[model samples]
Target chain A: MNTYIEGILILAGINLMAVLGLSLLTGFTGLFSFGHAGFMAIGGYTSAMLTVKFHWPFIPALLVGGLVAALFSAIIGKVTLNLKGDYFCIATLGFGEAIRLILDNVQYFGGARGWPGIPNYTNLWNVLGINLVAVLVLANLIRSRHGRNMIAIREEELASQIVGINVFKHKITSLMISASYAGIAGGLMAHYMTFLQPKMFSLVKSTELTIIVIFGGLGSISGSVLGALVLTALPEVLRSFSQWRLVCYGLAVIIIMISRPEGLLGGYELTPSSMKKLYNRLRLKKQAGKQGLEGGDIQ
Target chain B: MNILELSGLTKKFGGLTAVGNVDFKVKKDSITGLIGPNGAGKTTIFNLITGVYKVSEGKVIFCNKNITNKEPYQIAEIGITRTFQNIRLFKRLSVYENVLIACHKNASYSILDSILMMPKYKREEKQLKLQANELLEIMGLSDRRELIANNLPYGLQRRLEIARALALKPQLLLLDEPAAGMNPDETEQLMLLIDDVRKKFQLTVLIIEHHMDLVMGICEEIMVLNFGCKLAEGTPYDIQNNPKVIEAYLGVEG
Candidate 1:
């Protein structure tokens, strides 16, 4: 693959990992968080600063960045997670902007001039491995009893509460998890790009993540992966037409959503059950071909 | 002697007194029926017991523990679970998942176990599936295991609510208007199910119901409330003939 194309794919995979976490927070927990980009910023800048300022190892710095983002989210979540409905959205929006402004002005984090000379430790293999880990962790979480309860809370908080669910605790925990994932993605991203800027983690980045989650089915996992890929590649695919690309992008999203509002897959999950059926069918076909070849040899 | 006691239970929303210092006691393992007119505080008592709302003033003791100010989930942890007047099942979830989600508190798998899908998690999951299936079978909903709770017909949905609450394995089960939305035939079946379940689970049941015949048929004892205060408390026969109960049920025919 071309280096530029490979670079884009790697970045897209990182963004996909971050958005899958966002999908769990917003799509499953009924939390519409605008602060996701803030987490990404936290992760990217922390990892970048730690590596450049202290000369730490790549992996440890990245992990520390994730933990720092999780810690930040826990503190912010204590205040913002309680705000319901539109209020919650508004609070998260403000929080995201506040984080960006802090990063933009703070001298330690490049003070809007942007951080440079970070090593490009992230590559295709690294991004793929991280995405695999992200998918596995989230898939397990969704299949568990706690994930089921989170859906129940999303569907109806009052009923869940009466059924003995700790509403506040679960919401906060979920927010922290998503935040940590975003942070990790951000840290990986800074090392991959070999440069960082506070403006990279602005509201536009948050909206891009939101678009992927909303365009994906709210409660579906693979839907998020599909959404992220298509949305990321749609513009590139349209690049031959040059200026018409944005128009094509807008029209494509609008048409698809209007035609099938539940997203491409709706809420259908690619669970182990369906995967086993596919594997069985493929095995049967392959076995039949093998038998045919053996019979031909006898002839 | 009472296993659960409520003393001076009064709930006032501004000028309206919903429950007016009404005292009641629930004997151990007894099915007590609370009946009254539309606005009576029967449901309010269930809410108070479950801690949906803080009491304006009252003392609620369950099994020698003061649970007057306990949080809702705390109330459930202490072995009390209740259904709503309106059917409140997790509608979007499958019937089996609904019951499994309720049994989450009792689940033995740790968060790490779930995240890792270790041997212990898989074993517990199998056990959870079995337990959910048994509960669904008891409620005559096993065949509809994969059906979403909301898609079930109204009567079945109400039963699903009961099934979900029963999954908690509560020592005390409170039912608020369980038969409200059921047809006459369904009501009879529900009455039977309620009695059999109470016995099978060894649960102490406190039911607030409006259907007089069904309540009279199944309830071992009766408590009558009117305008948020106890109008009468006795056996079914005693409650039926009491003038105060009659006045509460029907205007005095002087």
Candidate 2:
């Protein structure tokens, strides 16, 4: 494959990692966050510092980056996850902007000037491998009792509590796991681009991640993966349109939202069993149509 | 032995008292009914007992333990679970999943165990599935296991809520109007089902109901609340004969 296509694929993989985490939070848990880019920033800077300043290995640094992001999310989640509904969304918006502005003044990692000379360790193979593990782990977690509790909390929080689920604890847990994913994604992006800037992890980046999740469909991992791949490549595919590419991208998103409000897959999964069920239903419909035609001929 | 005791229980919202200085004792393994007109604070009492609202001034003693002002989940964890006045099944989930989510507390496998698909996770999960299926079977929802909860008939939705509560293996079950939207035939079935559940689970039930026939049929003891105060408490016969209870239900003679 050409380097251009390979680069886009790698970018899509990184975005998929973050979208999977956000999918767990927004889709399954019913919590909306607009501060995930801040997590990416923390991970990016932490991992970059480890590799550049201390000469640490790539994978361990990435894991440490995710851990740091999870730590920060735990603190923020404790303070704001108690706020119900849109209040939590607003809190995360403030948090994302705050992280960016704080990073702007920190001179240790090149501050507003941006950091360069980061090793190019984020190859397509590593990205693919990491994303595979992420997806499997996420799929397993969603199918478990813990995942069911999160979905229960999302569906009806009061009922979940009445059913013996500790809602607050589960909310924080979702937030922390989500942040860790964003953190790892950020580390990958930093190494891939071989550069970092506070501005790169702005509110827009966070909004983009959220949009990808919603566009994919809530409560479906496969939808997030498809969404990440399609959405990340759309702009690059439209590059020939020049400055109008973004306008075209915005139009495409609006069209999808209007046409399918529940999202591309809604809450349905694309597993083998579901596919088989769909196929059987279609075959039965076809058989019924044939029977109707035969009855018409007899008439 | 009494399974639950409320002494001087009161809940004041600003100056408006929802449940005021009410006291009652629920005998162990007995189906106790709480009934009154609308706004009589029956649901408020359920909320207070479940820790949805903090008590203004009262003591809620369950099994000789003072559990007043605990979190709702904590109250549930301590073997007290409730069904809402409004049927609050996880609406988008399937019938089996609705009950299975409640069965979560029974399994103690960690998140790591689940994500990594450990042997312990598989073993516990298999057990939870069996338990969920059994509960669904008992609730008569086995055939509709894959149906979304919101799509179930109103009466079955109510039944599903009770089944979900039972999944917690709660010692004391507080049911808020399990027969609200149910028809006469459905109500009759519900009465039998509630009685059967109580016997099978060896549960102590405190129920709030507006249906006199169902309440009178299954409840061994009844507590009447009028404007947040205890109006009367006794057997069905005693409560039917009480003049004050009659006056409260049907206005005093003009």
Q: Per-model TM-score of chain A alone? A: 0.89, 0.98
How far is A75's C-alpha from truth in model 1 (Å)?
1.2
- Model 1 clash pairs? none
Off by over 4 Å in 2: A295-299
Interface RMSD for model 1 amounts to 1.1
lDDT by residue (A38-126, candidate 2, tens digit) is 99999999999999999999999999999999999999999999999999999999998999999999999999999999999999999
Off by over 4 Å in 1: A275-299
- The lDDT per prediction is 0.87, 0.95
Best by TM-score: 2
Which tens-of-lDDT digit does each residue in A1-299 have in candidate 1?
A: 89978877887898897898898898888899887899998988898888888998887898899889999999998987778788888887888899999888888767899888998788899788888888888889888877877888998787787778888888887888888889988998899888888788889899889878878778888888888888988888889999999899889888878998987666777778978988999999999889989888644
lDDT of 1 by residue, B198-239 (tens): 989999999988888889998888999989999999999999
Weakest ten-residue segment in model 1 chain B by summed lDDT: B103-112
